[model samples]
Target: MKIEVITLNAADTLQAQEFGADRVELVSAMNEGGLTPSYGTLKNVLQSVTIPVQVMVRPHSFGFVYDEKDWNTIKEDISIIQELGGNRIVFGAVTKDGEIDEQLLEKVIHHAPNIDISFHRAFDQVKSQTNAYKVLTKYKDNVKRILTSGGKDRADQAMDELRSLVQLSHELDGPSILVGSGVSPDNLATLHEHIGASEYHIGSGVRVNKDFNQLLDKSKINQARDILK
Candidate 1:
């Protein structure tokens, strides 16, 4: 098991790596659940961090129902990220009626099926996680992981759901679940012992007092990393 921390800038990325993160998910406006960072930010972060950086390809936070313009921007961003030497990325989408947007999912992932990619937390908003999981399995090779909170507001509160998802992940060569949302060093041990997931995505959990505005807590990050190991 390894820790993947959410970072907003090159400084944050450096801190994450120094504090024991194996990988970093680079984004902007984390309060809006992370938007695509500027090209300059991406370039600087790539040059600053030696660890694997997973660039987020989201254009905006206007829900998962995107227009054609949004789709174009998303595609362009993915290509640019790859061109800029970013090998890993995170992205996700959903229909207005609360189902997996198969059209968009396939459209984006089909082009770069071999790249390391993660389907982000939009999975929580889908009507049926079981059905959603089935949809994601179609691109199992491209969609390497699903970052989710077990269809709940918080992952720790939905252990049963996460456990079932993890079990399903082990079958059918589906993408494994990367548990997130309120996962902290204080409770990661319990989550791991119960859910048995191999990866955990931490954001505010590493921040002081679990506040995003505060600096990431070095002690908390190191503790979480040791526990995951």
Candidate 2:
């Protein structure tokens, strides 16, 4: 099993690495969900740590329904990150009716062939997760994984649904199901056991400072990492 911590910004990079997290989902502003971090932040993470860093490609905190300009920004950011040697990227796009915007997502994938792409929790925003999961499975050859809370507010609260979705992901031969949102040391082990998940995502729960991105309290992440083990 792998323990992944969500690094809301650069500050958490060093501590996350020290805490022995398998990977870090680099992003910005968890207060309004999460937005894309700046180029400098990404570069710093790339330089500061040896662990894998998956940069978030979201342009803003608004829903995953992006506009034309937002698509352009995502494409451009993908190019920049790839050029800078980012290991992976996380992002998502949805239609007005709340379906995965395959067209837009495909374009980004086309540009980022060498990088892993995790469809962020925006997967929960879709009108129908079952239908959306079907569509995502079709792109399994392209998408690397799905970060979801099973259409609920938090992973623990949504464990049953997450278990079903995990089963569905396996049935469809899609990418991994990375449970996220409100996950913490307290309930992660139980959730992982309940869902039989190998990967987990955490955010505010591990933060030890006022700034969301500042260095994680190694004790907090380590405490959870030990529990997961």
Best-fitting candidate, measured by lDDT?
Answer: 1
Give the alpha carbon lDDT tens digit for every residue of 1-229 in model 2. 7778888555577778877889888887778777788888877778788888888888887778888898889888888887787758888889998999998888876777666888888899999998999898877876778999999988888899899888988888888899888888778778888998768888877777524645577777887778777
Q: How far is 223's C-alpha from truth in model 2 (Å)?
A: 2.6
Runs of candidate 1 with Cα error greater than 4 angstroms are none
Candidate 2 residue runs with Cα over 4 Å from true position: 9-11, 209-214
What lDDT does model 1 reach?
0.89
> Model 2, 19: alpha-carbon shift in Å?
1.2
Highest TM-score against the true fold, candidate? 1
* Cα lDDT of model 1 by residue, 1-229, tens digit: 8788888888889999888898888999988889999999998898888899989988988887887899999888988887788878898899999998989887887766667878998999999999999989988878889999999999999999999999999987799899999999999999999999989999999999888778879999889988977
The C-alpha local distance difference test score for the whole of candidate 2 amounts to 0.82
**CA RMSD per model (angstroms):** 1.3, 1.8
